[model samples]
Target: MKILFVNNGLAGGGVEKLLNDMLPLINESGNYCELLILFDDDAKYLESLRNNGVKVQIVPKKIYNKGHFQRILYIMNYIKNNDFDIVHANEFPLIYYCSIIKTILGKKMPKLVMTEHNTDNRRRHIKLSRPLEKLIYRNYDKVTSISDKVQEVLLDWLRPNDRDKYVVVYNGIAAENFRNSKPYERSDLVPEISEKDKLLCVIGSLTEQKNYFLC
Candidate 1:
């Protein structure tokens, strides 16, 4: 199977990390795998993916700020040239883009898939975006939520018939990768930690969903 994973960029985030873990397995399954990163941010994970035999492609600079139609055209052209069988979008905007391809191009496009990694977002509450969101989501072959909570949140907003498209695909890590990993030394991140200072680490983005203010 030819599969393409689409994302805005491979920035440091949970979704990226999850994809990082999934790529190797995808390749090992004897399938052709590729990544379509919309914008370049000099992501740290780029090298690791290349090392693992995943082909990564970035959209050209000219298409970045033109408009939605132009960006969709760029994506659609890429999809056509690559002949991907499945296009799995990591974020919601890309889902809408894939939806457009499926809507206009019909069977000419690949099967559209989207994975929802977050429980909340601005689009759900915006009245004007709801109609478009509904239309796009209806075209997706599958919509996976990272957890049951996330599925519930999506169900609260998605239409009843669209509920059939929803599925809970909990995120997973590659446990074997940590099997032979060396223990971390103090100077790795914080040089201030002498050999004795106990360090408390918190991992999350500084977004409202993380609720870092309470921490």
Candidate 2:
């Protein structure tokens, strides 16, 4: 299968990391996988992806600078020319853009899939954006969420009649790394630690959506 994964950029984020880990595996399985990043800036995983034999393409600088519409046109042309079997979008505006392209292409467009990583986003808070959101999601052939909670919340928010289109695909991890790792001494890491003290670790980007303060 020929698949094109679209995202904003290859920044140091969970989505980027997921793509970094997932794309190579897809390629190794004999499926042709390519990445299309909207911006060329802050591409932390570009070299790593290329080293893994995943074809990574960025929007042309001239077209990127031209404005939103121009970039959309570029993406449309790129997808149309690539002849992909599937186009999986991984982030916000890119999801919206790909939906627009699918709507325009109709049956000519490839199978459109989007992964919803979060349970909430700014778009959900806007009262007027609901209708457009519904339309955008309707354009997708399938919508995947990172967890059951995310899928539940998304379905509740959109309330689409075709509930079967949504599915839960849990995020992956390199379990062997954890299984083969050594345990750290509590006293060595924290000299002030008590023998009976319990430690809690929270890992994620310190973004507003993470709600670190709540933790």
Candidate 3:
């Protein structure tokens, strides 16, 4: 299938990491995967995707918000010009755009899919004072959550009656990449730490969802 994976940007995040993991499998299976991202950045993730034969495009954004109409137009036009079987949105903003396109264009639109990467995020605070979230989500061909907990959280918010529209799809890890990673000394981060003392470490974005407070 010719799938266009849509996300906000090529940042070192869970969503980008998941795509990096899946690109090899997708390419090996003879399925083409393209990337559509908003904003331009000098991220190495772009080179990785290009090296794996994934086409990447930078869609211009006039506003910082994900649900901006200008970005929606760019996405709509790109899909309309391309022959894609699926348009998979990896974030809430892209999901909302795809949903709108599917709802408006119907049969003319590509198969819309969305993946919810986090159980709790900023999307819940959309104070648009509208009741069209469920209606928008219904337009998607399929909705996936990274885990069962994420699915439960999404369903509780969307309140979709069919229930079957949502599914659990665990994110994959690129195990081989870690095999040759250079180990860092604990003293590099902590001047008071001794080399003999074992230290606990945490990785990933230090956001609220990461729950660093628990540690």
Candidate 4:
């Protein structure tokens, strides 16, 4: 199957890392997978993805600089020309654009899939956006979330009757890298602690959604 993964940009974020890890595996499984990103700013994983043989396409700078509407047109045109089997959108605005494209193209559009990465977003906080979000989500063939909590929150917010459309696909990591690496001695990194000292580690982006303050 020919798949096109769309996102806003390739910044150093969890979503970007997820795509960098996932696209290569998808292509290796006898399927054609390509990425369509809106911008090229601070694309930390761009080289890594290309090295792994995942085709990464970026919107032309001219079109991207014009405005949001122009970028949406470019995306629509690109999708129309690519003849992809599945267009999986990973983030906002692009998700909205892809949803709108599916709506406009109707049956002609490819199987539209979106991955909801966060349990909460600004759209959910806006009362007027709820109906619009429901309409946008309804156009998707499948809606996947990175965690059960994300899926639960999304379903509760959208209140869509077709509950089966939402699914939880947990984020994955390349565990072998951690397993194969040498373990670090606690004293080597932080000499202040002894063997008896209790320690806690938190790994995630320092975003409000992560709720680091709760720790």
Candidate 5:
């Protein structure tokens, strides 16, 4: 299978590191792994892929900060020229582009997969951008929420039929990669978390309505 990975940059963020960690296992499965990073930030992971003999491509410039419609053309052009069996986006912003604009490149666009990494309710952008999301997300073949809470939040807003399109795919850690690569644990580097007496936990942002704070 030819899989194309879309990310905003090659920064050492959670999503970026996760993809790099999983690349070896996935490539060993005989899938062609191609990376299409919108940002040209450092390309820190580029050498890792090349060293492993995996095929990677970086665009000349990032179109991420550009307006949505403009990014549509840039992404669509890229997808049109690339023959990929699947296109998966790790972030929600890219998810919008993949599901909406990527479909216009061909009658049968690549199977679209989006992984929701954050709490759905925490997303302030979505409430205001519901119309845009409804149009684009309809084009996605699959939508994965990383946790049950995210799935529930999505269900409340999504149509009943659209519920079937979303699945709860738990986020994970690459055990083998952790054993081999000396990557820094996020919480360890952050000063707030205690290394000896506690476990690191993720918390979503508080939501504010027209007059009240919810959750």
Candidate 6:
């Protein structure tokens, strides 16, 4: 497939690393994978993608918040002008991008896919938002999430074309990385955790749905 990857940031973030892991497999299969960064301006971690001979494009955002508007035009032109089997995007903003543009252009849109990383993050702007999701859901061919928890949440918010459309593809670690690293002693990140006590960590953005507490 001729795939174009759209990402917001590429500073060795989890989403970028996910793309890094998948690019090798895509390259080995002799398929075309192109990288399009919405915010990245430097070659921070693009070496792997370049080394694998994948095409890269840094879509310059001439305007501020209007960058999303520019991306809509750029992507529409690319889709209308060239041949791309799939357009894969990570996170919600890019997902929202392709969804809106495809609606405006009608039938010439490419196949849309998403790799959602988190379950708790959701849209809170549109009330009774099921109608909006129902519309955008028609634009996406498939979605993959890291865990079943996320899949369940997605099924509730984002309707899919097929029941099996949402796949739980667990992220994998390389055997070489495991073999190279030695087991180190474990220590409590927080002080004074007894045997009866426990350590827990929660990860999410500063969004309100995350329910983070400060005190």
Instruction: Tell me, by TM-score, which candidate is best.
Output: 4
Error of 4 at 16 (Å): 0.7
Q: What is the lDDT of residue 144 in candidate 5?
A: 87
- Per-residue CA lDDT of model 2 for 1-215, tens digit only, reads 99999999998999999999989999989889999998868899999999999999999899889988898899999999988999999888999999999888889999999999998999999989999999999999999999998998999899998889899999998676699888888987889999889887778866787777786
lDDT of 6 at 32: 79
Off by over 4 Å in 3: 60-67, 126-130, 178-192, 195-198
Cα error, candidate 2, residue 201 (Å):
1.3
In the predicted model 5, the residue pairs found to clash are none
Worst 10 residues of 6 by lDDT: 183-192
lDDT of each: 0.84, 0.92, 0.81, 0.90, 0.71, 0.72
List clashing residue pairs in candidate 1: none
Give the per-residue lDDT digits (tens) of candidate 4, residues 1-215. 99999998888988999899888888889999999999999999999999999989999999999988898889888989988999999888888999888877888899999999988888888999999999999999999998989998999999999999899999998787688798778987789998899777777876787888787
Which ranking of candidates, highest TM-score first? 4, 2, 1, 3, 6, 5
How good is model 3 by TM-score? 0.84
Off by over 4 Å in 1: 181-200, 211-215
Compared with the true structure, what per-residue lDDT tens digits does model 5 show for residues 55-102? 666655445556677776777787778887988887756887787765
- In Å, residue 12's CA in model 6 sits off its true spot by 3.2
Model 1 lDDT, residue 42, Cα: 60
TM-score of each: 0.86, 0.91, 0.84, 0.94, 0.73, 0.74
lDDT of 1 at 135: 80
- Per-candidate Cα RMSD to the true structure, in Å, reads 2.7, 2.0, 3.1, 1.5, 6.0, 4.6
Task: Pick the winner on lDDT between candidates 5 and 6.
Answer: 6
lDDT of 1 by residue, 77-190 (tens): 898888789999988678788888887888888888899888889898897877777787888899999899888988877654857789998888788888999977779878
Pick the lDDT winner. 2
**Once model 6 is optimally superposed onto the true structure by TM-score, how far is the C-alpha of residue 44 displaced, in angstroms?**
3.9
1 or 6, greater by lDDT: 1
| lDDT, candidate 6, at 161 | 54
Model 1 sits at a Cα RMSD from the real structure of 2.7
